[model samples]
Target: MSNASFWKGVLPAITTPFHADGSVDHAFLAKHAVQLVDAGSTAIVPLGSLGEAATLSFDEKVAIVATLVKAVGDRVPVVPGIAALSTEEAVKLAQAVKAAGAGGLMVLPVYVYTSDWHEAAAHARAVLGATDLPCILYNNPVAYRTDILPAQIAQLAGEFANLQAVKESSGEIRRFAAIKELLGDRLVLLVGMDDAIVEGLAMGAEGWIAGLVNAYPVESVQLFELARDGGYAASAELYNWFLPLLRLDTVPKFVQLIKLVQAKVGLGSETVRAPRLVVEGAERADALAIIDHAIATKKA
Candidate 1:
């Protein structure tokens, strides 16, 4: 795929719906993908940090990608996140998802071990070389300990033909300008953090790999459009209204909290995979209050 054809606009990193038995809920997963696309999302991204990817097996991950590919068909791209405990496994996954009919890849730093630039770049290069699919290098140092800085991202972009975009999630506004200054539009920049959409766009971010979009895709897309198109008064009001809920994406429990929002809105359930559970007591109540407030007084 060409750079213009893929990796732009609102790409919601979707959550994996699970059955009561703790198995992958492929049915709802497929339904949710189409729903997001129908709601104005530019693409469907599966198996990211928000999707509880750490708990899924390799086969399950491939199946999730295939499910999304079949679910969305030609309407949108199914870009599965390439991640694993080992570089070899991550390479295998990149190739497998391509065979499973994924349109693109969201290349991530290897899981768990936070490596230096040498190791991180090598791992990313391995995955990038595994397939010719267009890729978006996901750089969220907050969640994924390995930080691929702007200089390193430029190096990878120069080396790989398929490295077409960078998902900037460092929460640093300066990184957007830093990457743009280095690459000069050679690579498209997408905002990976939900709360940073306006600021990222101000610094030349053309798209969004959003998290809160799992529950509020329309509002998320609206926020991006308002900010991107310079709708000052409307954008400010919407950002103020959406800020509290969008901040949920920056926290550690974002997965459970987003799923809770989906459940509250009748979109999906709160069932997550192992090593993470649904929020409860004070945490659950606090999250519910945020979601309710957004719904009750939503204008922008």
Candidate 2:
């Protein structure tokens, strides 16, 4: 796939829908996948951080990706997250995503033991070198704490043909400008921060890999469109309205909060795997209030 074709506009790192008993809810997952695509998402990302990919087994992740691929049926690209602790496991997951007929793979950095720039570059090359499908380098130093510098990214782009895009979540506005300058349109830079979408677009970001889109696809897509059309005033307005919920994702309990918001909107179940707890009492009520306020203030 070309750099422009993989993941443009609002591609939600979709959350996995689980059953009341905590099993993968394939039926509801498929339904929500269709709804997201139909609601104006340019692509669907399954088994991502927001999807709780860490807790799912290999078989479960494969099944979820296959189900999403089947549910979307080529209406939009399904990019499954290939997040693993090792380069070998990341390669295995990438191959599985490709074999499942997904359009591409979102490869995250190895999180267990952080590496320096050279090691990180080799790791990225090894993972992408394992698959023929297009790959999006997820530059989330906030979560991984290891930055993929502009020079390192340029080197990777020079080395791998399939490494065509990046999801910049470093929370540094200067980094976006630096990427645009260094890459010079050689790569597609998608903003991974919801609040930075408009600013990133103005700085030449191609699209967004939004997490809140799971709850508000319409608004997310609208923000993208407005940014694409240079309507920063309008885009900023919508973005500001969703800022409360977007800010909530920065919390350690964001994964649970996202699922809870999904449940509140009747989109998916709030069930999450163990080692992660569901929000309760004051926190839970506060999250729901944010969601409600977002819904009420949504543009027509």
Candidate 3:
């Protein structure tokens, strides 16, 4: 896909809805993909952080991608996450994901083991080199610990034409300006952090790979359009209300929290895989309060 064709607007990283038995509910997963597009998402991203990519096996990831491809089927593009613990693993998975009919890849850094700029760049190169599909380097220093800095991102973008975008999740909005100054349209910037969406768009980010969109895709798409269309006054009004829920995306239990909201809105279940539990207690109460308040005070 061309840069202009695939790399703009709200691309919600959708969750992999699982059955009560913890296996992926492929039927519901496909249904959710269509709903996100219907709800105004420009594209669908499966196996992303919100989808709990780390918890899925290689075959499971491919199956999820195939299911999404069949569901969305020319309606919108499906970009699956390329997350792994090593360069070779990521490249291998990228190859499989491409074969599964994904339109693009969101390449994340080597998980767990912190990598320096060169290692991070090499990891990106390996995956981009292995795939024919366009790739977006996920620069999430806060969660991944490996900061793919502006210099590194510029280097990769310059080296690989396919490395056309970066999901900037550094949480510092100034980094967006710095990146734009350096790359200056060479790389499409997608705000990876949900809380930074409005400022990121205001600063010239072309898209958002949002987690909150998994639950509130309609509002997420509306916010991105409002900001992109220069309706700042209205966007700010909506964003202020969204801020409380958007903040949940930055929390450690964001997967659980987002899934909880998804169930609350009648989209999907809150059934996460092992090692992570569903959002409950004060966290669940807090999230529900925000969702309820947003509904009660929704603007016409």
* Steric overlap count per candidate: 0, 0, 0
Q: Which residue pairs in candidate 1 have backbone atoms (N, alpha carbon, C) closer than 3 angstroms, thus clashing?
A: none
| Candidate 1 residue spans exceeding 4 A from truth | none
lDDT of 3 by residue, 57-162 (tens): 9899999989999999589888988998778888888999788888899998887889887777777888899987888888888888988778778888888889
Instruction: State the TM-score for model 1.
Output: 0.97
User: Model 2: residues >4 Å from true position, as ranges?
Assistant: none
TM-score of model number 2 = 0.96
Best by lDDT: 1
What lDDT is obtained when candidate 2 is compared to the true structure? Answer: 0.83
For candidate 3, what is the lDDT? 0.86
lDDT of 1 by residue, 77-165 (tens): 89999989999999999999999999899999888998989899889989999999899999989887888889999999999999999
Q: What is the lDDT of residue 230 in candidate 1?
A: 89
Worst 10-residue stretch by lDDT in candidate 2? 1-10
Candidate 2 lDDT, tens digit per residue, 105-144?
8888886778888788878888889988888889888788
Worst 10 residues of 1 by lDDT: 1-10
